[model samples]
Target: MNDTGRQSRHLGIHIDRTVGEVYAYASDPANLPAWAHGLGGSMERVGDRWVAESSPMGRIEVAFVPRNELGVLDHHVTLPSGETVHNPVRVIADGAGSEVVFTVRRQPGTSDADFERDASAVAADLARLKEVLEFD
Candidate 1:
């Protein structure tokens, strides 16, 4: 699929942890509620999928890619409206530490203000992730 017309912004934060350490923690859907507030404040594992009932966007479903060594933490978020948004996340080595990057793409009908709000939420979530991994 051609994505040339899609507007995307990559938001990232540096973490005081190794790539493996960050990947292992962030790639686990069970650990999301603690750090990924952008997804929701509460999450539960139901069968093979993680369900978030208190998400800002209402009840949603999240499905992450299978574990891998390449630091790919990509996931799919199924919105309350049944629209699935593809979130591309990655953890990469940065010397002795690592950096986590999340790509926020503006949906077809999303307004500029909403897109920025979404970006801010992702940024906050990344900050929280760093705090959890580095200090907690």
Candidate 2:
């Protein structure tokens, strides 16, 4: 938890792949459906923004950090209720592989269990990413 008493957490996975490879896949908005379960099924570009169907949350907007070799994958998600959440993500080299981390911020008035569930969801997505990118 940070000084503001919000449950900001970092969830990550170490993949047996290069940082570039991991970054390439994770940084693509089109690839969100394959791993980002919280963001619903499909996504598309509208004008200069990316929009996705977020199941129960209706359609939401997403914006990603500009492409960079620094492995920064920070993105912003605007919920249906007009709330924007900043998601700080990164892909970094780790020994023979790479580490991908996503930061989940605590929404206003979020309960403890809800926060844990959110972290668990991120971990699950990372596992899905590793499974998809590390195929033999």
Candidate 3:
């Protein structure tokens, strides 16, 4: 939660593994295209930052702090009216498993319907990730 009343939707699961092992798999940029649906391009390192291109989301920039066990991904998508919506994803490790939180703050004059749609997409992505990591 933040001052803007924009709270993230947090998802969590516990795995029978060490935090480091789970973190390694989750933080690997190369694994994104395998589990993440819309990511089409490879993740490359630009100095200390990571960037990936997606067909649906365009270019996304990510920053990670391994010591703090935090990651942030920032991206934008255009609406039907040509308005851009910002989507931020925050990833953190709680214990054996990790917690993934997604936040979407609507642009000025944007409707809540758009936010709901984006949130559903995020949920789907997370669900896919869980299936890949846990079952596969």
Candidate 3 clashes between residue pairs 3 or more apart in a chain or in different chains: none
Candidate maximizing lDDT: 1
| Cα lDDT tens digits for candidate 3, 2-116 | 3333544444444444555555666675676666565545777676655675546667555444433444444444433445456565555666566655564544443567656
Candidate 3: 10-residue stretch with minimal lDDT: 1-10
Q: Write the per-residue lDDT of candidate 1 for residues 1-136, one digit (tens) a residue.
A: 5453399999999999999999999988889999988678888898778999999889999999899989999999999999999999999998899999999998887887888998998999999999999999
Q: Which predicted model would earn the best TM-score?
A: 1
Clashes of 3: 0
Show where candidate 3 strays beyond 4 Å. 1-8, 11-18, 67-99, 103-109
Root-mean-square deviation per candidate: 2.4, 1.8, 5.1
Q: What is the lDDT of residue 81 in candidate 2?
A: 90
lDDT values, one for every candidate:
0.91, 0.87, 0.57
TM-score-sorted candidate list, best first: 1, 2, 3
